[model samples]
Target: MNILMAIHIGAGLLALPAGTIAVAVRKGGRLHARAGTAFFGSMVVLGITAAILGPFREPEPLSPVAPLFVLYFVTTSWVAARRRDGSTGRFEILACAAALGTSAVMYWGVVMDGATTPAGPGVIYVLASVCLLAGLLDLNAILRSPLTPARRIARHLWRMCFAFFIATGSFFIGQQDILPAAWRGSPALLLLGFAPFAVMAFWLARVRLGKRLRASLQALPERKLA
Candidate 1:
C-alpha cells in the first residue's frame, strides 16, 4: 500500500512538469510530442495507482469512485488527441457514457450525504458539472464527426487541460498543507493552480482564429485563379 502511494505521488510529481512543458512548447514538434508522451505515460501511471488505492481509503466507496472519474477523463482526452476528423469509435462513445454516468452518480452522492463528507458537496458538484459538460461536448463531437482540424485541436486542448487542471487542483489546493505555512492559501498559489484552464482557453481561441486565417489565405489564390 505504501509502495503504491509513493509511486502515485512520484508519478504525479513527474507528470506536473512534463505536462507543463508539453503545453508550453511548439505544437507538432518532436519536443512537444516527447514531452506530451511523457506526461501522458506518467498520468496513466498516476491515475491507475490512484484508482487502485482509492478503494482502500478510510472512507471506503466514495474514495474509489473519484479516481475512476479521473481515469475516465484522462483516457478519453488522450484518445481525442489521436482521433482523426470524421472518426467515431466505440471507445469514444463508451467513454462519454462513462463520464456522464459517473457525473450523475457523483451528484447523487452529493445529494445523499455530501455535507457530511470531508470535502463537502461543493467539490462534488463542481466536478459533476465539469464532467457532465465535457461528456456532452464529447457526444456532440462524436455525433458531428468530420470536425475541423482547429476544432479537433480545440477539443484535445480543453480535455487535456481540464485533466491537467484536476491534477493541479489536487496537488496545489487540495494538498496545500504540504506547502510552507506562509504559502498556504496564497492568491498566487490559487492563480498558479488555475493557470492551466486559462492557457487552454487562450489556445482554444488562438487555434480557431489561426485556422480561419490560414484557410482564408489559402482560398485567395483560388479566388484569383477563378
Candidate 2:
C-alpha cells in the first residue's frame, strides 16, 4: 500500500472510534462540531483519493466508482445544507440510488468475477447502501412531523453521521487487510468483513442511545417520557 494511501485509510479508520468518544463527552456540543469537521474533511479527502486511485481494470463507466462516490458525497452535502422545506428529497433519492446502483454492480463483479478474493468490498457496498436508506427514511419522517427543535437536531445529526459513517466503513474495508489466509482469490471474507461495519453502527447507535438514556434518567422519572 502507498504510504499516503495507508494514512488516508488509517485516518478514516480511526475517525469512528474517535468520533464516538467525542460524542460521548459532548454529543451535540462544540467538541462534536470540531470532530465533525475533522471527520468530514477526512471524508472529502478520502473521496478525492478514491476517484483518483480507483482501479482502472473495470470498463470506463464502471471504473469511475471513486469519482462517483465523490460526486455522491458532494451532492448530498450540498443538499443537506439547502434542504430547507424538504425540497431536496430528490437528492436523497438519487444518492441512495447511486449507492445501491454501485453496490449492485460491484456485487455482480465480486460474486461473479474471478479477480476479487476478499468479499469485503461487496459487503461494504451493501451495508453502506442500507445505512444510507435508513438515514434517508429518518429524515423523511422528520419532515412529515411537526418540526420541533429536537426533531431538527436529530435529523441533522443522523444525516451527517450516517454519510460519514458508511463512507469511513467502505474506505477501511477496501484498503485494510479484510481477508484471511483462506479467502485469497475473492474479495469475500467469512463474515468477518462485517466487523468494522458492526462497530460503526454500534458506535452511532450507542451515541444516540446513551444520550437519550442519560437525559431521560436525569428528568427524575415523573417528568420524563418512558
Candidate 3:
C-alpha cells in the first residue's frame, strides 16, 4: 500500500477499539476521557491521510469527498463535547460552516455523477445529507442561545456516534476482504458495523425519556408538599 493508505489504515486500527472503549465505559471518567482523546486523535490523522490519497484516484473524483465529510463530522463532534455549557465559540461556528460547505460540494458531485457521469451518487448523497443535517442542528443550537445540559449531551452523543459509525463502516464493512473466510460473512460483522448506531439510539432515548422520568419523580415530593 502507499504511504497515505498505510497511515490511514494504521490510524483506523487505533481508532476502532479506542472509540469502542470510550463509548462503553462510564462517561466523564478518566478512562473514558483518555480513550476518547486517543480515538479523536486517530480519526483526525485517518481523515487527513484519506483526504490526501483520495484525489490521486483520478478515475474516482468523488472519492475525496467522503474523507472531507468524515473530518467535518469528527471535528464538530469533538467540539460539541468541549462546549458542554451550550456556549457557542468561534471554533464551533467555523466547524458548522465548514460542514455546510462540504455538504454543498457533495451535493454537486452527486448531481453531476447522476446526470452526466456513471458514478451515480456512490454514497455521496447520503453522506452529504447527513452533514447538512448536522450543520443545521449546530447552527440552530448556536442561534437559539445556550443549550440545555440534556440537549448538549444529546448533540455530543449523536455526533460522536455518527463519526464512529463512519469509522466502523469503513473498516469493518469496506475492508472485510482482509478478514478470515469464516469471519467475512458472519452476522457478528454486521453487528460490529451497526453497533455504534444502536448505542446512539439507546443513549438518545435515555437522554430524552429516562432523564425526564427521573426529573418528574424527583419533583413529585415537592408537588405533594405544595
Global Cα RMSD, each model: 3.4, 7.7, 3.0
Model 3: per-residue Cα lDDT over 1-226, one tens digit each: 3877888888999999999999999988999999989988998998888878876766655365667767777777787788767787787788778878888877886677552335445566777788889889978888875888788888888888888998998877877899987789788888899899999999899887898899889878654554
Show pairs that collide, candidate 2: 116-186, 116-187, 117-185, 117-186, 117-187, 118-186, 118-187, 118-188, 119-187, 119-188
What's model 2's overall lDDT?
Answer: 0.53
TM-scores, one per candidate: 0.86, 0.49, 0.88
Assess each prediction's global lDDT (C-alpha) against the native: 0.81, 0.53, 0.82
Q: How much is 16 displaced in model 3, in angstroms?
A: 0.8
Score residue 76 of candidate 1 by CA lDDT.
72
* lDDT score at residue 221, model 1, on the 0-100 scale: 58
Best by TM-score: 3
Clashing residue pairs in candidate 1 are 86-146
Highest lDDT against the true fold, candidate: 3
Ranking by TM-score: 3, 1, 2
Candidate 2, 1-226: lDDT as tens digits = 3765676566666655554554455655677657666666666666665555556334532244544554465345434433545443555556656665666666667567733434446544564465456446545644564444344444555555545545544544543566464554444532333443454455556655767888878986565578
Which scores higher on TM-score, 1 or 2?
1
Clashes found in each candidate (C-alpha, N, C closer than 3 A)? 1, 10, 0
